[model samples]
Target: MRPLDPRLLRYAAGARWFFAAGAVLAALQTVLTIAFAWSLSQAIVGVVEGRSLAELRTEILVFAGTTIARLVVTWASGSVSIRGAARVKSELRSRLYRAIGRLGPAWSAGRSSAGLTVLGTRGLDALDDYFGKYLPQLILTVIATPVIVAVMFWQDVLSGVFVVVTLPLIPVFMVLIGWATQSVQRQQWDTLSELSGNYLDVLGGLSTLKSFGRAERQLTRIRVVTERYRVATMKVLRTTFLSGFALELGASLSVALVAVGVGMRLVAGDIGFGPALFVLLLAPEAFLPLRNVGTNFHAAAEGVTASEDVFAILDEAADAADATATAVHPGGGPSSAATAPAGLEFHDVGVSYDGTTVLSGVSARFAPGRVGVLTGPSGSGKSSLISTLLGTVAHDGVLTLDGSPLPSGPGERPWLAWSGQRPGLISGTVADNVSLGEASVDPDRLTRALALAQLDGWDADRECGVAGSLLSGGQAQRVAVARAFYRALRPETRVLVLDEPSSALDHETERRLAASITELAAGGLVVIVASHRRRLRDIADVELALTPAVAKR
Candidate 1:
């Protein structure tokens, strides 16, 4: 049940075919195993009874052929299982990536990059054993065990009784071991996630640690986490080994009991020589798949644990998306004409995070052909207000567009554009970063945007390393501003929002950027800027200041 997490089977539609094929191959292998065992008995009994070598040769060949076929089918089934696992892993990773994107930066801000990384990469890769060995063996146990046992009964009823009685014990022991190892496996997986997150975090802050003269102390922390992980892993391995040994011992004893029964019956002349020998050979075959399943389960437990965590995230994301979808206005909500920007009205609007109210009972209005600046101290919710308007965060009370309730979801408004405090850039040329998937890059418009943001000296073709590392702080800010302008140039863009636009700029550059905001407002777009700088506030047609909410006595 733990191995068969429903979310995996439910979400990975493309990979289901591989599982189906593996089950079919398992059935085929089961048939071949029984057939080979029958032919092997026939060849041995015929030779012992002094039959012609020519007659026995046919049984020998059939046995050999069945053996070869089983080998080939097993190899093919293994290949199919591995390919299916890869496909499932790929599909799950894609779904996770898309879900993370839909959840937006706010949700991601609360999670560790290293933890998510390990979940998507190493955590998923751990499923290889589950799919490739454990699942196929499990299918064989389900399909092949009863059939082989029935065949044993047909050959000799006493030996079949022994197998039937002993088969239940294997699963009984497996369940007991599973109970003990389940918690340990879960603990090991959690430890692994912690280790991965801590190591990546330490590495990211290595420079800060060195500057603060605390770099060497971090080694002790890392070592402690690593040792904890090692201990957890060793505990899982010990339980797995002990469980495997116990199952093997039980299977061996069961086979021996059947062998002794069959041999005693032959000595008493209660069964034919051929039947006795056949039952002896077939007794162990009945338990082989079941024993292998027990052995393989340990290898797959880690993946099952990781899969539970992945499904939990996917489910939460789906619920959030469903909630947002219901909140969306069907008629595309409020829209502005090409010549005028939409008016925005906040009526006692409020926002909260983790039970702490950031903005409460605030009201404001900004209209077309006007610039609105939000002035506030840190943690006074200027950025949160911008996020609310952009539909990134849910808010209580009402926000209206042209005097109607606004749509309540991120990306619900194509007309809105925003530039955040930290500019996010990929590893690409300057033009690539600014154009950002635009089908046609207009040289004139790009040049104008860059000039307005005071980035005219930067080469359009120059490479901007990851997160714009090649550029200085102020230059990166300008690049983000230029991208915002380029987006605002689109015919559908009616509202422009900038958060801390001049935080990295000097007086001259800040003045130039402020001029650009006013120019955007003059062109009939409602422009909103969240900044503390006087240069930006001085240029705004309307200024809204926010204060921290007071606690009631």
Candidate 2:
């Protein structure tokens, strides 16, 4: 389903009542405002006809009372509208993040970080007007504008028709300009989103670029992106300026026509001077709201454009889908946490993406007390098989643990420990990265896991530096693996899946990793590692090489 617009109604439904009340007040203000103008005409006409001073005082009192009341109601309505808008923007951002969460990694990989960011910052921002200004103004246009026209018509139907006719011109010109700029605005939004992503990437890779002595080259690339963003922004601005000019000119010309008509009618003695003057005065106010609507809507365009991505994210399939719950350990066995007693088993499990096969019909078992090692070439579907075992990837074929089919989709799992080639670390002390959500690791367990992962030297008290800037490749990689081991270390953890365990490690580090694997396997842990490092073979019992055919295409 298409996602809901980031709107106020979703957050503070109670505020919707306030918005309604505000619209009503705004409508009343419109009538009083016009009535105050009429009263002025009355007071002026009465005074000119040699009315008494006391009558003039009463006339002035009426104008003051009505105008002041109108201002109060208008202010009250504006307050409600603004509050509603602010609340909706905040709620919508939270909703967007929530939606992104639902879709999981498979779904998230398809979207750009820059696009998601724009949706959060700009997309939610659009709701400000969607709730506060555009909506209220639109409501006023629907309820108040007509009432204004009716009052004008009551005094002089011809003037009423003249005022009503001007209303269509403002929107007609606006829509015409809107059509012309729609494509440009879309292009501008795309450019802005891409620019945000590029900038974020550059900043993220700044250190890496500097290390490679390519920071200057990246800076030049960033300058190019900045110039592109500027050009796109200027294009949108030019079009917006043209649109405003058209709307302004159209509204002004139409109001001027009303004035000329009222003047001509009064000169022809078709109506009294007082009524004609009233019609002339009220004509401009009727069209002002519509013109304002166009301008305010223009301001909202950026928000609206950015909100599309937010909406898309909200509509995405969640990260924790039920269809992706089952996991298989790299030993080609069902998740060990399975309690059914059927034990973990993988029967001809296979997986493919975009017609390119990653894992093919393979059968294996990881019943407790048996440790299985998955050994193969770099692209031999070893890691892909591990992903299926970890329930991180959707796959084809049957996986059963303890005799029952494994859960296939969504939600956090309690039993698995799978680490990828490059593990991520959040900003915090070393202790925080190691536990993730796992309870505080005991000092002994922490030390042992760190030693096994070859990161025993890291001080728990030091800051990890945004993604652990202080850690070397081996350290970071080991830290990631240690997190899995420490996070609820199931000594009986049925399957331990490792992808490229020795990718960047030196011989000594690789030796330590192999020793850790051997110890874990000897303890009846079914361990699987994707490795080209033959040193791993010392600890591995079964070497399974996934041929291109074995892993599908």
Candidate 3:
């Protein structure tokens, strides 16, 4: 997470070899460039001194061969490096996706679809520069530039030291410029991500807002946010272009100085024409890499910003590692009890987000085979309580499950199946949407669960449109319930949580859905629903009325 960390390299353990080989190729190319220039000078000077034609021919052949070798190595390195960088990007993207999948609500609640899409798409794309272009070029510049300058020094110290002294300025300015622009680039990326998230939310809910004549206002807000991001982006771009221009100007001036000095020495007869010409040809290659590093530094600025985002998402408190599994793995800890009586209990528990409290001090108990309903006015802490029990929210007090304090990690103790108050809609058959996260779901179980939610009537093979577009809100809610049913059908399923279970349903449908939920709970499943509707209170084994606070024990 440090600004200067070589994160992409650390993750690219397997592909570093290819990168190293690419660096070698770059060095070889630089060596060949010098060798070719050196050979040409020797041949010409030898001819001028009345050397044999056959010797001249030999030098020419050697120079030609080295040039050819340089080209071959350069070409092969491009191929190998591009493929290797692509491999790194692919693997990193996969890890990112899997990590996000595991993170679930922890990340999803805070991010937007467009933002995540960008993170997965162009955001991950910055790694290509890190590995393919910048890394290989940087390595070659470091390895070959000094050696070339040393050769120039041996040929003529004045020219060698001249380039050597001026050479570091490119990288020096790069560091300075990169440092100056780092914060700005980072801000630009963050603003872009925020814009992406907001845009997705706006588009997703545009229809609803339009029905209430709020679409114009939403668009205005989006434009304001986007313009702000644009200003930030323009500022970063200005700095980036300046860095590149400075590097280019500095390199050009250095090369010009080398050319003028070499020409003067050749005229003075102090250094022979042959060595002087060679220095002139090879001087730019020394500075080219440094200039390139500056260019690459700016080119990869977004990638650097994007990579920072990727790392934050990847490391955002990874699903609090399974404590028992970890404890048992290394030190051989206690065994997991079959009935540890690890039911969830909350006492004086409260939670909040962004400094605004969502849940206040609360006390509750969830026992196996019992049904619990949390009811309150809209914006009350019913849903937050469920999140507290699930450990998705930061809590102020104690929460225990099955007599053991609930593990603070996600997907750990008290395995829960949460059917969110707001269900996801996707393009597919009814069956597909109901079974998005499940692997190899049973058809019979699927049929039963669908029936429980009163969705048995819909044709299973019919297209639901994108996100069950063919279905009405009540129908989608029923399908979502069916999904909860499918998850609960698992033999290991212990706790099933629902939010607004009957929000989309009418009187009769709500009645049926309530009955279905009761049937599930009656069969030893721990069912918890957050609702304000009085209709579901009848079936709840226990009813909890939540407000701003619950008295501490």
Can you write out model 3's per-residue Cα lDDT over 1-553, one digit (the tens) per residue?
1323565566555467665777678778777878888887788788889999786898889788988887797788778767876787787788778667566464587767788889889887876776556766777787778888988998899999899788877767877887778888888888988898888888889899999998898878889899999899889889978887898899999999999888888888889888888788789888887677778776677777777777776665453344323432112122234544545566667666656777665777777777899887876888777776565655566655555455543555326777777778688777787776656657888889889888877666667787667888888888888888887887888889999988888999899888888888878888898887888888788888876643333
Candidates in order, TM-scores: namely 0.92, 0.81, 0.84
Worst 10 residues of 3 by lDDT: 327-336
Clashing residue pairs in candidate 1 (N, C-alpha, C atoms within 3 angstroms): none
Candidate 1, TM-score vs. the true structure?
Answer: 0.92
Q: Over the full model, what C-alpha lDDT does candidate 1 score relative to the true structure?
A: 0.85
Whole-model lDDT for model 3 versus the true structure? 0.76
Candidate 1 residue-wise lDDT, 17-82, digit = tens: 876897799889989998898899888899888999787888988898998999999899888888
lDDT of 2: 0.71
Write one digit per residue (lDDT tens) for candidate 2, span 130-187. 5566666766776767777887899898878877766787877777777766667777
Candidate with maximal lDDT = 1
- Which 10-residue window in model 1 sums to the lowest lDDT? 328-337
The models' CA-based lDDT, in order, is 0.85, 0.71, 0.76
Report how far off residue 26 is in candidate 2 (Å): 4.1
Please identify model 1 stretches exceeding 4 Å from their true place: 325-341, 398-406, 410-413, 438-440, 550-553
